[model samples]
Target: MCAFIKVSIATFAVCNRISKVLGFDDYKFIATPVVLLMLSFSIFVTQNTMESHFSISNIWQYYSFPFEAIIPFVVFIVAEIRRKRTKVL
Candidate 1:
């Protein structure tokens, strides 16, 4: 859990920086879909390589929701807070 939070924040930070440097103010929106697609593709590939079955169980599907949904939501919230703070200064 700790590792997941750390990696998620770090990934968001790096992608945020890159987007800024590339002049994209709405980078979070773009990054979210791309990251999700990559994650889904990787999971599919990994399951194919290691498991006899390619399908993910419903419980495991539920487990993935937080990582996919929560992390980006947190990142967006944090980014919004920071943006507001900087604008106020």
Candidate 2:
């Protein structure tokens, strides 16, 4: 569990850097789908693991992936929204 959490954090950090490098800040809506896909993958795998008697907190533990994905997604959203509002001004 600790390893998984660490890996997830690392993954999110890399995603943050990648989003900045790829200029995803200009595309807020695009990140939504990618985040959803990543979240779905994590949920699916967690569910499969649960069937094998592995302990995964259905509510909180399963939510970790979305929380992880949200960090970068939120950054992009904030940047995009700021850019748009500035343009309108």
Candidate 3:
């Protein structure tokens, strides 16, 4: 449950970055479906690779620290800092 929420938030953050990078902020109808499809693909691949008995422990050992959760959180912090710096200047 917590993992799901973390992943959803990260996905939204990633989607926002993608939209900004692609200049699609005005066309969320287009960017949204693309982002969702990519998210689904990522989840599908992760699930299949992690579900296997032999690979389960390996993945858990390497990824147990919630690196996915950290990435978008770090990105958010950096973005906020940049925004604040720009506002101050």
Candidate 4:
């Protein structure tokens, strides 16, 4: 769990920087919510532990069906937008 948090933080930082440089501000924007949601879910599942913290009950009880999927879908959309925009440059 600690490792995952660390990695997420590191990756966010790197992505934040890279996105800014690439002028894909939308990447960072879209990433924030997705990353936050995933981290929150992960933390909940980890139950404040390193492993097996999240249970089926918790996932069903607390989070909704679309919670996990939203981030990636938004990311893909943003990526496609960025791709399209880049093609014109």
TM-scores of the candidates in the order shown: 0.39, 0.30, 0.44, 0.33
lDDT digits (tens) for residues 31-72 of candidate 2:
555667777877876676655354544465776877788788
lDDT of 4 by residue, 1-89 (tens): 99889987876776777688878845556577666877797677566543454555565556555666877789899999999999999
Compared with the true structure, all predictions reach lDDT values of 0.77, 0.71, 0.74, 0.72
Model 4: how far is 7 from its true place, Å?
A: 14
Model 3 Cα lDDT, one tens digit per residue, 31-88: 5786679768878766764376566667666775566677878989999999999999
Off by more than 4 A, model 2: 1-15, 24-27, 52-89
| Residue 69 displacement (Å), model 4 | 0.8
Question: Residue 51 in candidate 2 has what lDDT?
Answer: 59
lDDT of 4 at 10: 76
Model 1, residue 58: C-alpha shift (Å)? 2.7
Worst 10-residue stretch by lDDT in candidate 3? 48-57
Kindly report which residue stretches of model 3 are placed more than 4 angstroms away from their true locations once superposed: 30-32, 39-53, 59-89
Give the number of the best model, judged by lDDT.
1
